[model samples]
Target: MGIGDKRKSDAERQERRRQRLAVDGIKPMTVHFPDQDRSIVRDLSRRVLDGQSIRQVMRELGGSNQPDGNVVPPEVLAELDYVKARLVAIEREAASQLAEIEEAERQRRTLEAERDVARVAEAEERAKVHTTATEAQAATRAAQEAKERTTEALQRAEKAETAIRRARSLPGVRGRLVRWLAGDVLPD
Candidate 1:
């Protein structure tokens, strides 16, 4: 291809790569460094991806300059420090919130356990009350049966006493015979 066409093709390829990276949610680093220090910056980016703290990565990088003696700008270093502080603060806040959520969950579980115990106890008490009521009903029925039996016996005894009195009032041989058999003395 001609030189101009090659350049145009390379630009198009770079643009496509950038678009693909963006779509994949991989943000390109905005920090500019000397060409000779690109390897170090790439290493730092790798450490960040590996979940190292920003402060730790910065410490590892140290304040070393490029082989060409090109030091990072003072303003950029200051900005890095500021960003690291903000990240630390945000992490601390997240930890605090996580601790609070765990505490709330523990309390909720405890309350649920207590509520379950109360429900079980309430059911037990209801069972006891139902048993007591059943026993009372049974007792009432037994008492009624006993009273009915006693009343019937008393009625039979009264009828027997009336028959005995009527038999004693009869006057004749049969009455005399009945009195003798009943262990009553006969009248002269």
Candidate 2:
């Protein structure tokens, strides 16, 4: 009816109207495809409502066959590609850091094991020294006891010798002591 509305009853008239619509500056409303970040899709129904040419809009945005082989707006599709590349780089960095952390943990465990071994060795050495000192102390006590016994024996022997000498110095005590020692009774 008007310059924008080009609805025709006949097929030929519709074709002519479509061509005229393409020449006009009318375009479909753009819709952002959340699933596809790098591209957007122009709504053909909205284009018809706005008295615009759906074919022209489809052709302008790569004819609905995007570079990625999908009917998506070029803008959002490019953004998605960029996001994918960034995510790959981030994953690579994370993997590297994880490897480093694993290595560091391994080294720490190794050092701890070594330290435990050293501690055990040192403790064993200390135990050995303690045992040796105990043995030495016991030996020293035994030697001291033996020396005391020998001294007591010598003192007893010396006392018996002195008693024998005193008896000999007496007049008849020597003969009487000898008779008693021989198990024979002496005259009073």
lDDT for each residue of candidate 1 in 1-188, tens digit (9 for 90 to 100):
89999999999998898898788566766888899999988898888867777667776697533332346778988999999999999999999999999999999999999999999999999999999999999999999999999999989878876666677668998776666665543232
Candidate 1: where are CA atoms >4 Å away?
1-72, 172-188
Local distance difference test values of all predictions, in order: 0.83, 0.72
For model 1, what is the alpha-carbon lDDT of residue 52? 79
TM-score of 1: 0.52
Tens digits of lDDT, candidate 2, 73-172: 8788799999999999999999999999999999999999999999999999999999999999999999999999999999987887666555545678
User: Each model's RMSD to truth, in Å?
Assistant: 14.0, 13.9
Model 2 lDDT, residue 43, Cα = 57
User: How close to the true structure is residue 116 of candidate 2, measured as C-alpha lDDT?
Assistant: 100
